[model samples]
Target: MEHINQVIEQLNLEASLTLEEIPQIDLYMDQVIQLFENKFTESKRNEDDKVLTKTMINNYAKGKLIFPIQNKKYSKEHLILMSLIYQLKGALSINDIKATLTGMNQKIIKEEIDLDSFYTSYLNLTRQNVEDFKVDLEDSVKDVNEEITGDKKGDSPYLKQVLMISSLVHMSNLYRRVAEKLVDEITVEKEEKRHK
Candidate 1:
């Protein structure tokens, strides 16, 4: 129970930078890398894991996952996009991310929306989702405990941990599947329109 509480607490502390936390000035590539590294160090899975890298940034530019840099400096918009890409990479394919971001850039180019407006909306939803997730996790723990109450092994910490991990993985897989389907639909719609 203590371990479970600690996990929940850590989840609540998951790092995400607000718009105000990002540097307002354009940053050189090295500066951009350093900023992400410093901000997301705690989010890394291992001590050796890098939060961002120059090669990764360059590849994002080449793949059109991000807007082009100007005078070798990344603007705030670029940083926001990169941050989004970093977060989405675990749950989305690179091609899907490219398609989504490209569509967004087209909208901004056409004056349909501004970057800050979109990012603000995203941030709002992210914060709300995290809170919702924490509640859901607590509820899941209770449910799992009840389900295993009659079994001889029910009191085993290992059993609780296993069940919780299984439940969480199942839920995440469902969400990922739904997101992938939506991305596929978006890609197909774009292709069909281009052919018309």
Candidate 2:
């Protein structure tokens, strides 16, 4: 329990770089990896965890999940796209991620919003929700713990932990499904507007 509390505290302290904080100058692949490693050092759970990798970046480009690099250098837009890919890869397939990003990429290409502005808006929106999300997560964990404790069926502690994890996984999957649907709908709506 103490360890769990400590982890939560650490998570609350962790912060991603804001749009303005990201480097404005273009970076080569190795530089991009180094930058991410430095920026995300505090957030890494273990030495084995990857921050970013050359192969991953190349794979993303090959998969069309991100825009093509220019002169083998990544711009701020590429950094933003890489960040999104890193976060989304946990719960979404590469194809799904590509579908979700395609609309935004089109908007960027059309000068609807620059990369910095797009990332800034995303940061603002997520920052607004961060506290609320923390509260909700704490509440959910407490509720699960209380419910498990109240049960008198003599379930083992390990089983209780498994049950808690399963419940959380289910909730995460549901959220991901909803998010995918929402992204698809938004993309369709944008396409309709473009064609009209």
Best by TM-score: 1
Question: Looking at candidate 1, what is the lDDT of residue 48?
Answer: 100
Error of 1 at 153 (Å): 4.0
Deviation of model 1 at 104, angstroms: 1.2
Estimate, for each residue in 97-175, the C-alpha lDDT of model 2 and write its tens digit. Answer: 8888887777766868777776777777767777776677677667767777788774457756677678778888998
TM-score of each: 0.93, 0.84
The Cα RMSD in angstroms, rounded to one decimal, for candidate 1 relative to the true structure is 1.6
Query: Model 2: runs farther than 4 Å from truth?
Result: 11-13, 155-159, 186-196
Global CA lDDT computed for model 1: 0.85
How well is each residue in 2-91 modelled by candidate 1, as lDDT tens digits? Answer: 377677665434677679988999999999899889888877767899989989999998998886788999988889889899889989
- Model 2: colliding residue pairs: none
- Among all windows of 10 consecutive residues in model 2, the one with the lowest summed lDDT is 1-10
